[model samples]
Target chain A: MYTMKWIQQDLQQYVQAKAYVDTIIVPLIPFHFSDDASLEKDAFQREVLSVFMRELEKEFSGRILLSPDYHYLKSADKAEEVKRVRSWVEDSWAQPFHHIFFMTVDSSWKKFEQDMNGTLIWLPQIVTESMQFSERQSVVHSQVQQVGEFIRSYWEDDK
Target chain B: MSEDKRPVSRRQFLNYTLTGVGGFMAAGLMVSPLRMAIDPVLQKEAADGDLTNVQLAEGDITNEPQRIDWEIDQVDGWYESKVSKTAWVYKDDNGDIVALSPICKHLGCVVSWEGSEDYPDQFYCPCHDGRYYKDGMNVPGTPPTAGLDIYEHKIKNGMLFLGKAQPREEA
Candidate 1:
């Protein structure tokens, strides 16, 4: 539990450092919803995510950019959903984010690489029983460092 | 001597003994009700107690009440388990911090604030259509026997905190 807290704090600092370049893009998975649940029929998850984003917008204001939550659709339909989400971001969001953080059990690196235009940050499934109790501080620290490095390298080359 | 020991003396003796025993039993039975009546009178003197302060702060109106959910371990002889609980904190109009329990007094239903359009600015219990004013008073025609339980509070810095509530004094 203590290690988890330390890791969370470190992640917050890392995200804050990256905040200078772009708003943090966090893709929340609707894991609580069953696979059979119809996305269009059930708006609970969308409403909750909307409320969370609004609250975050209030807290961070102009200092950060938060893209609307993506990945509510299935893996087969993910490509289309990603495109739709990207368009929504371009139209609705004030600015584009530099880093895209994806939390998933499966490391679909190639799929995300092809879909997203920004730097891809893969987060290991942290909610599982094994990861929940394991010494995950170093593992999380390394992942954040890798993502941060990618962002720095990508944006610096762009400039 | 056997012939002289007749029915009259035996009946007289039996009557006196039965009366004595019945009187004793009657006095013993009356003790419980007597104690029940007198106990509250004696208890009233000690009931003038001090209110517990929950240590809230000034100017801390967050629009939404801060929810603190916790679990307490309980033991009953051999059995043990955790009991889940929650409390909501808000500031009253007088600037005094107040905490109201979510449990309704009527039938122990959970009452939520601003739940319906009819009572826009009050707590509403969906279970029985009961309503309470924001300050915790029960609506006169409502099913609740008493008002919402107002938890004890005190001011510290700028954050509102809470303590357990006592039953409201009867009107």
Candidate 2:
């Protein structure tokens, strides 16, 4: 239920009720289906990441905001990309949000984890063809549940 | 001419009749297994519409909105997955139990109890900042075009059972 989209009326209500929303989640997605062999796998990974993020939002609705996805080029330099990512985090933090979670399947973010101000949750990129639907559901359900628990602890720690 | 007179014996006639009856009896016996295999698919659709127990006691319901999280087994095509569902439950002034779907009507984002700063007693959405009143009604100037949905509920043996939430009538 976490989304950045709202009509004019909803935005007005959000502005007035800013204090109640305390956390914001931003997903960084890298679009890198340049090669033919990896295109399908990459696309599958993207879909999985999307579902996982939605699950997280559903788990902690009202407490967190699901902002627009952060799309970046696969060929881009990770070092330079950190600045752009930091900017997005800063912009979202301007609100009274006490927690900002960066959800990503990109391995590049691993290096920038310490540099970034927010918490970086880097999920291992999955090979979609290797797993069946039922297996994937179980794998996703368990891992996503753990991630939810981790983020929950942060909120709990605050209290 | 010879073939026409081949089954004239009484014993031969009885054998033919016995074989014919056996085939029909075997098919009749198969009907029970066939029904057993297919009945669940037909009956499941109707039986699942019944309410799910939320494990809350009648005395536990208070005026303040309390979030309840539970999972339900959902069958989609070939896979059976447990989908998590959430609801906000509380008691109104008249002491009636009230349950509302936390999803925002504006754009399907999850709404929260007292999530907004301005609306202290209202359900607020962080996505577009939608708001709903305490009675699950959409605020006049809020983003939600309709009131929040109320869940079908009943109390059995002091326990609350909740079904799907239906759209409330708008005035």
Candidate 3:
């Protein structure tokens, strides 16, 4: 369902399912190329965020529109980005999406989280190199479980 | 040719040649089945569907439908991905275990158990307010024109092995 494009045919059905589920998730990511050293870590965190979003989407599909990854420079200003994010959420084509979540690994979003219209969920970067499969699964599962809980809470509040 | 320097009898030559041809044909016929029996060790299965183990004990299942999630390796064309499959599993009144697919037949929205307050003890799709009875039969006049699908399932060592969900005719 997280294919790169939501084509015309998908758009028609999205219109119909709009009444049932009114939420879209935008995974906010920071892309950095300031240096060879820090960019690697940023890339790693982005990959972890990708895994997290896919896991969450699989658990609650169709109900959760996994929007395209929102990428910005690591050094970009957060206060300015908040308005862009608000406009993106507002541009839902009048389809009545209630909740907009901004999923990120960058803790910078934490400082300005209140200013943004979307829910900013800043996750800790998962150390991917040394972990075994079972450990990784446990880590990812525990984190996604929390995300699911948050979604449920938001659903209740929305009602 | 090695030993029959003496003029061969017509019967002797005919008998020897026929025996050799018959032996060759007999050996040719046995080769295919022998190779088939050993082929499993030589090649991998490409078309076999995956069966995921939904780690639910046989005793845990009851008349009340329980939703269980499990992951399986899925092959779609050239891409291999881990797909999460969910089923509403429970034992029916007859004591037979049933696993039903939770997808609403109308437009593939995920249906929830008793999602609507008014539709007591029924599967409800928030989309179009589709409803299904406890038995996975779609209620008429709902947007869904067909019943929820049933997954092919088997119990192995007390664990549930689930296969593809096959759609049944509308109630």
Candidate 4:
């Protein structure tokens, strides 16, 4: 159940074991530096999404490759972002990933979800910034469990 | 200066040379053993000897397996961060505390207690429908090739401290 570490040795093993590792999870992060008001919200979402992805990776480390985060400007056009995300999918396809999922907390991505090449999973915004660590953890844990089940459902369809 | 530089006696010269070489040999012999004796004291483990306080009260553990979550400081190469960990904890028939790693042996998926409705008393992995008995033993003919890992645990004053999870031999 060892996940792929971003190192040469782990990657060499990944290439050797390509049949076992076929799924990829990409986190879509949005940054808004132009407006000070939206900065905190964007930052909060980024943090929450990363935690969610980490938990997901732990759940299915052997079969899934956690790709680097994909960052974009919040003010960027949805059409333009779709093109950029599709480019990423094309590059990822070179590695023979059968399943590619893009996880995001921004609701705006839902409008252009179908235009993207991979599946877009938009999680609801969680306002747990002020909550205690334990409280927020439980919240994230429950959501991550549901998301994991959802991903498994897709894999089941293939079989 | 000339008087002091008078021809050295062979006996004095040999005595000085022998003392210096003997001192060098003794130091070389002692250095290796000294470093070996102090090596453990200089090394610090990422998990502080692999035991982290899980913050669960001893009384809280019951016969039914309960999920426990805890955080530890992990150092990965040059990066340091807090990593969250989870375990399935319960008391066995003999009233002994048992902690098992929830990672499924098949494909690294997380297993849950009674996850599938059909398997009410066993740990189930939703990824490939893998099942394990209550004691963390994988059901025969399942996808998992090995049994679940057991964690080293210690009870201190009412709190439970857990160490690394050691893999179990297949039954």
Highest TM-score against the true fold, candidate: 4
Give per-residue CA lDDT, model 4, range A53-85, as digits (tens): 877888877678888888998889989989989
Top lDDT prediction, candidate number: 4
lDDT of 4 at A124: 88
TM-score of chain A of each: 0.49, 0.86, 0.87, 0.92
**RMSD to true structure for each model, in Å:** 17.3, 12.3, 5.9, 6.1
lDDT of 4 by residue, B1-171 (tens): 875886777788899999999999999999999998977776544444578889999999999999998888889999998877889999999989999999988777789999888899999987667899999999988788788899989888888999889898554
Q: What does DockQ give for each predicted structure?
A: 0.03, 0.12, 0.20, 0.42
Show where candidate 2 strays beyond 4 Å: A1-13, B1-163, B166-171
lDDT of 3 by residue, B33-97 (tens): 99999788664342123566789988898888888978887789999998777899989889889
lDDT of 1 by residue, B1-171 (tens): 765766468788899999999999999999999999999887764442323223434454555555444444557799998644445666666655567776767545456677557788788765355688877788889877798786655544554444456667872
Whichever of 3 and 4 has more DockQ, that candidate is 4
Q: Whose DockQ is higher: candidate 1's or candidate 4's?
A: 4
What interface RMSD does every candidate have?
Answer: 20.5, 6.4, 4.6, 2.5
> Which lDDT tens digits does candidate 1 get at residues A1-159?
000011465346435544342545555444334555564433443443343333323223222344445555444466665676566555434544544444333355447565555445555444322454224433443454454444345444544
| Error at A29, model 4, angstroms | 1.6
Q: Candidate 3, which segments miss by more than 4 Å at Cα?
A: A1-9, A93-95, A126-129, B1-64, B106-132, B138-146, B156-159
* Cα lDDT computed for each candidate against the true fold: 0.53, 0.78, 0.78, 0.85
Candidate 4 steric clashes: 0
Q: Which one is best on DockQ?
A: 4
Kindly give the stretch of ten consecutive residues in candidate 1 chain A with the minimal lDDT sum: A1-10
